[model samples]
Target: MVVALVGNPNTGKSTLFNALCGARARTGNFPGVTVEKKVGRLKLPTLGPSRSGGGGAAEVIDLPGTYSLSPRSADEMVSVDVLLGDAYGTPRPDAVVCVVDASNLHRNLYLVSQVLELGLPVVVALNMGDVARARGTTIDAGVLSEKLGVPVIPTEAHRRRGLEELKTAIVAAASGPALQPVRSLPDAVVAEANALEGWLSEHGCPDVPAYLRERMVLDVGGQVVERYRTRCTGDLPAHLGEVRSRLAEAGCRVPAVEAAGRYAWAREVLDGAVETTPEPAATGSDRLDRILTHRVWGLLAFAALMFAVFQAIFSWAGPFMDAIGEGQGWLSGLVQSAMPPGAFRSLIIDGVIAGVGGVLVFLPQIVILFLAIAILEDCGYMARAAFLMDRLMSRLGLSGKSFVPLMSSFACAVPGVMATRVIENRRDRMVTILVAPLMSCSARLPVYLLLIGAFVPATAYLGGWVTLQGLVLFAMTSLGAVVAIPVAWLLRKTWFKGETPPFVMELPPYRWPSPRNVALRVYDRGKAFVTRAGTLIFAASVLIWAAGYFPGDHTELHAVQAKMENPQVAADMSAEAWDALEERRRKLSADLIADSALGRTGRFIEPAVKPLGWDWKIGVGALASFPAREVIIATLGTIYSLGGDVDETDDGLRDAMRRSEWPDGDPVYTLPVALSVMVFFALCAQCAATLMVIKRETNSWRWPIFTFVYMTGLAYVAALLTYQIGSRLF
Candidate 1:
């Protein structure tokens, strides 16, 4: 049996789904719409008093939360089509579980009423029962069930309360009476629906249900019609026009009629079933929102919160990150000590270990970022953040809905692009997708940390309250968000020109975040990061190691090692001679790298990147990073591993980079070069995963290709300007 879990946004539908299915759920996409589909197995109880283990697991699908079945967006339309069994790859659900917020019965019932109109047996899951009771609200489930002709189960999903009851209700509904439409349309509206059904059949439209026929005439230019438009035959627009004209002539307006009728029936159904005391003058959420949502104070609070988060990522994660680096170094030493000196040992230590470690060492920051975001989202401040950003987004011709996805890009761009399904306007969604990657992702964190630590002085600002390194790191991340604004404007004005959709969002009440939810979310994010590190970054690292390692000449390397190990020469040599010998070794290492294929390729691209103040070595690292921004660290690790003969734990790469000099004896990597590199990485579209997701979301390679070209061009220009100006100033 198949069942769908449906509800309005913020109704705790997801929480209920998780409670029901736990870890049995899997995620995919709906047939035609790109919206995510979550399905899980719900093992059903037996029918009678025994309620034994006789039944099989029911497949429960969690549809995207939507306000109504009128279908404003593609995602919302998905709920309608799936319920009607019109969506491919999904049959009509055996029963529908309509989860609603118990505290907001009147408003929530509006959607429940629409679900009832679909002619499917619905078991109402009155979620947030605890919150409702806390607010002095009482819901008579039996009364609600009698009034609505379905089971109403009061559920506290977070506590796993009423789940068994909810399951039982689902089983009862599936086996009970056949359902009928709850809200009947007016005679005139009914007549129009009947006439339109005939016209639709003649035009080769599918045999839509009576309620769906009513929605067809109601929601003008909605996703439902757009979804099936390909199969529609013989002047669909004319048939729709005639039906709408007759309805309007009979005094039933198109969109308003549907809303008015649904809401009227909802209010009637909710009348005596829900009883609420007068709200207090100042609720806890209201008191907090007064400051958090204030125009001036909210902005300050948001900035402070972001600053604290970035600071924590830098300061708190330092020890853990260092330990990872040291651990990798120790493992490399153990392998080096045990194995005979050969190419395989070198590959294991230098290629695999160094490359993978470079990526893994940044796991602390990624975990911290995911934890913070999960906290914000779970505690309900994320919605307020969007509400705060909406004001600024409107001026740029982007919807407020775009802010959430854009902010999500900071963790990873794949989900950020996926989050664009919430955006109702096609133009707004595409524009948001185009610019979201400009927000610095966790992948770029390693680059920022490496460069900022190497170049920026670790001095305290504001009398030790702020560290300069942390501030620079924060600035680099913020720069991405800043640069995205103008790029988004340009894209809005040209490629995706359209009127911005009005932003409507609900700021859910603040509550202590559930630790379980937060942990699960962080775990999922960490797993995804580790998976990419093992696959893409690992492959790139090995490839880079090969390019930097051979034509297999270790003559110069052995000579340098022999000289360094000679105690007799060390005793005879003065300090200056010792320094000179070290310099010679460094120069020989550089020369060896230049002889390798990777170095040759870097030299070929050197002139092109010279304007940005990059040497051939930095050019190679930058080019290798194209597959993933995180791969730059691995690439650099592999480069320094093969070239400098240094261990991973020695902080050797940064030191080598600092000591690097041109043939003219000028420094290769200065503060200006570091800053320019950071700027470029901040804006570049480097992650192949992000590009792949963009292509999938857009359903075309054109947008991803365009994204790469424009972002790379923009990054080059920005880096060039930064380097030129910084060179002059510094």
Candidate 2:
């Protein structure tokens, strides 16, 4: 049997899901939509045998948190389809578990009313019961159950309270008969809905549910009406308009009438079932919000909080990163000793290990970043952050809802783009997705750190409060965000022109973040990073290694390398002769690389990148890193003849970059060149993963293509300007 869980945002629905499924949950995108689908095996211990004649487990699908059943877009429509068992690859849910915030019963019941109309058996999980009691509110679950004609189980998902009862209720409700549709609307509206449903059956569109027909009549320009309009021909639109006009004349409007009717029914059912004492002058959350959400102080607090989080991400991950680097080096050494010194050795040591290890070193930073974000989100600070950003975002014709996604882009763009699903406005969501990649992600962190550490002087200022390197790092990180401002504005004005809607978000009462939830989120993000490194970065590394290794004879170079490795030959020669042999080996290695296919490609693009103060090697690294931005570190390590084990902090790779020279013997990398490179990567859409996610989220190649073209052009121009101006000034 299959069951669905639906709730409004901040109702602890996710926490409840975690409590119900725990490690059994797996996440994937719903078919044909970017909205995340979380399904888990729910063990029903109460029922000995499966109600559906299967195992004693039910598959629970966690639908997205929404305020109501009304769908404005295709993504929103997924929920309704799933409930109706119309979604492809999904069975009709045996029952639905509607989770509601006990503290806010009136508003929560609006969605509850809609679920009741689905004609499916539902078990109400009234969550956050503790919060309700803290406010001196008491809810009689027995009365509520009797009034709604369903089981009502009070739950505190975070504390694991009432979970057993909730599970038992789910089993009982799934076996029971479906609830009759709620007659919340007036008879006039009901008559019109019934007539419309019969008319639809007479037309080509048959089997339309009574609930959907009522929604079509009530939601005048909603998705249901638009959907049936296409299926049935002949003045359907005019008929809908007439139906809505008649409803309005009968003292019921199309959309507003639905809300009024449903809310009234909710009040009638909730009467005497809930009791509350007079509210205090100011609750703890209210007092906290006074300071936390203040216009001026709130901004400062937010900035300070973000600074702390970023600082932790950079500093706390150092030891773990060093450990990973050391481990990688040890493994490379072991491989070099065990394997014969040939093509396979090079592939293993220089290609696979180096490629994947280089990116994996940043796993700590990724973990710390995700951990901080998850904690902030769970603790309810992220909502306040969005509220604080709304005023600023409105000037760009976007709401504060766009801020959370953009903020998430700092750690990675793929999830940030996915986060855009929370935004209901199509224009705001699209604009946010297009500009999200412009926020420098963790992938660019390696590039920035490498460039800044290698080239920028370590000069301290403000009594060591800030150093030149730190300043450069901060600038590089902030560069993309600053650039995103105008890009977002331009997108709003040109393609996604629309007025910024007033942003409204619930600020859940502040509480300690759940450790289990935080750990699960961090684990998911870290695993995703590791998987990408093992797959995409690994493949790119091998391809680059081949391109740089072959298409030219390496026989002579290998012979020289072999001779250099022979200790007997080294002892046979004098110091000067030994030095000369080493020099010859280095020259052979360089010459072989210069003539290789990768070298040719780099040289071909050298002219294009020269304007940005980059040499052919730098061009090669940039080109190789297009598939994954962090691959540039491994590419450079390979290009400089340092094995892939070198990281941004590796003295060898940094020294190689510093010593690099052009044909005329001038230094290839300088302060200006470093700045130019950092800026280019800062603004570039270098990750193919992010672009693919954009395509998936937008459900179109055109947007991703447009994103790539626009961002790449922007990066090129920005780099060109930085180099040209810095060359003269510095």
Candidate 3:
């Protein structure tokens, strides 16, 4: 049986899902970690075979956190359709768990009431009840259960409290009845809901009542009206008939009026069950909202927070990163000493460790980045970040939800693209998808750091506290995001013209994030990263190694071996110069890579790209980074006198790039080229793997093709502009 865990974005639904399933959880960060859907399996330790339902092995899918049933965005609509059993390939949930932030019951119940209309069995886990009581809010759990006609369990999922009780509730709902009795709205409200159903008849069989009562009320909770309409190919005929009837009766679509009634009915049901005493007429959220939502300070705080994230990536990961480097270096030496000098030894040292280790070295940065993101996200500041940008976003005709996804694009476009699922309007989702790739992703990190660390002087810019290099990094990312804003605005006025979805979202109360919860997240995301290192990364490394390996016989250091095997060279060199000879061997090893197939391919692309000012080496670097962008550094280092440098990854490449040259007596890769490269990456569709995944998620080649073509075109134009303009000025 499929048990769906549905709740508002931060209501601890994921934590609870983890608790129930333990390690059985499957994580994809799908559509790229932004529209992450976690599906986990659970087996009851001991179940009465005769009595257990669905054969006792259960799979629970933790859908994207959605606040309501309205299909406002693609992902949000996924929740609605899944609950309605209308989302293609998704089974109707045998039972659903509606997780609510008990402390924020008033708003939480707003979703709860919506779910009740779905006519399905549900159990409400009054999550964060511990926080609720601590905040002097008393929740009458038994009363709420009786009023809503469902099981209620108080849980602190992060602390693992009340989990058993929650499971019991879930099982009871599953085994007792296939469908639970729905809480009927007041006669007038029900009549109005029916009237909505009548009005929506032109919309189809899965009418407004089914969506309102099933997913919104009984399953997911919260009345989120998604503006993007979805009707299956098979259902379009019904929709056509429905739309015909609706147009036949004009002035009948009353989304505003129906919304008021839903809220009114919700208020009545929750009136006395949950009590919140006013706090001397001022709340902490309110007080903080004053400054945090202020037009000026809010922006400054955002700036400061963003600075911290980048600071952690470049600065905080240094010592540990260095340590990791030294350890990998030592390991390589040991392997070389132990293994006989042959292709096997080189494969282990250069191909496997160098390539794999190159990618692994960046794990620390990923961890640091996601940790900071989680902290800001959990602390509720992220919502405020969205709030602060509301005015600016509205001018661009965007919902506030569009902001974080765009921000996340800096780390990776895949996640950023997926995150746009939170936006309910198809046009908004589409436009956001189109612009997300423009943000400088984490793949651009290695390239940016390589250049910025070398060329930009590390002296204080405004003061000694801020290095010019750090400021430069921040400015590049900020500029990338800034460029996307005008692009989004332009798209709205042009090809994406339709009503942008209305932005109506509840801001949950701010609480100190649970460390236990944060710990779980750190571990979960870390585990996911490790798995990638082993799987996709492992495969990509092998493929790249093969590309660099073939077309040469006796691949045992072809350049180094040729010299050593030469009798004249052997006679000239004495035992005293063996160490020098070995160093020469390393340089020779590096030279062979330049002549290899991978190297030749770089030369092939260089001519085409040279007008954009990149050399053959840059072409090789770009080629190696298809799987992931950070691998470019390793590839570049390997191409320039650092044999097997992809494995023996080093920061020296940045310095190397500084001293490298072109044939014309000019610097091959100067500061402007570096900046242009950064801009190109910020706008370009560089990650082939991300493009492939986008194809899988959208289930069409069309969107991915559009994404790749438009983004690459934009990247080229932007790079051309920057270079042509910057060259004249500088």
Question: Ten-residue segment with the worst summed lDDT in candidate 2?
Answer: 528-537
- Summed backbone clashes in each candidate are 0, 0, 24
lDDT of 3 by residue, 1-730 (tens): 6788888877878778877887667776333213456788976433333123444666788877776666545566667666777655567777788999987776667667666656667889899887677677888888888777789899988788998787767766776655553543334334434554544455553444444532222121122332213432234334334543453354323344345556776677677787877773556777888787778887898878777776666678777778887888899888865665666776787668765665566567657766765676667777777677666678778877677667766656655564565564667667777787777776677667777766666788556787878887887777667877788888899888866656666565576766755666666666765664344555666677766655455455545555665668978888877556666766655565567788789889887767677888887777676666666776666667654454322556665777788887788876667777777776677765456445544546687788778777777788777776766776
**Could you give candidate 2's per-residue lDDT for residues 529-595 as a string of tens digits?**
5663346555656777788788777677667667766778877879898777766665666666667
Against the unseen true structure, what C-alpha lDDT does each candidate score? 0.78, 0.82, 0.67
Question: 1-730, model 1: which lDDT tens digit per residue?
Answer: 7889999887788778888887777765676555767788898886843222234568899998888888867777788889988789998888899999887888888888888878888899999887787778888999999999999999988788999999988888886666877764567777777777777777787587887777777878876566556677877766778878877887888878877877788888878988888874456888899999999999899878867776676677778988997999899978866765556777998789976785676567668767887788778897788788888889989866787677767766765776676575667888899999998887798788888878888899899999988888999989989988888888888877766777877777787777776776666556655663345556656776788767657676656656666678889889998887877766655666667777789989899999999988788878767656766665565555433433323377788778878889999898899999999999988876677667666756788899999999999999999999999999
Q: How much is the lDDT of residue 658 in candidate 2? A: 91
- When 1 and 2 are scored with lDDT, the better candidate is 2
Identify the runs in model 3 with alpha carbons over 4 angstroms from their true place: 19-24, 29-35, 41-58, 86-91, 103-107, 130-139, 156-161, 178-253, 271-281, 340-346, 393-483, 486-500, 532-534, 554-591, 613-618, 621-730
When 2 and 3 are scored with lDDT, the better candidate is 2
Winner by lDDT: 2
User: For this target, which candidate reaches the highest TM-score against the unseen true structure?
Assistant: 2
| Superposed model 1: Cα runs more than 4 Å off | 31-33, 48-54, 201-204, 208-212, 233-235, 278-282, 338-343, 354-363, 399-433, 440-479, 528-534, 546-597, 610-615, 627-679, 687-706, 720-730
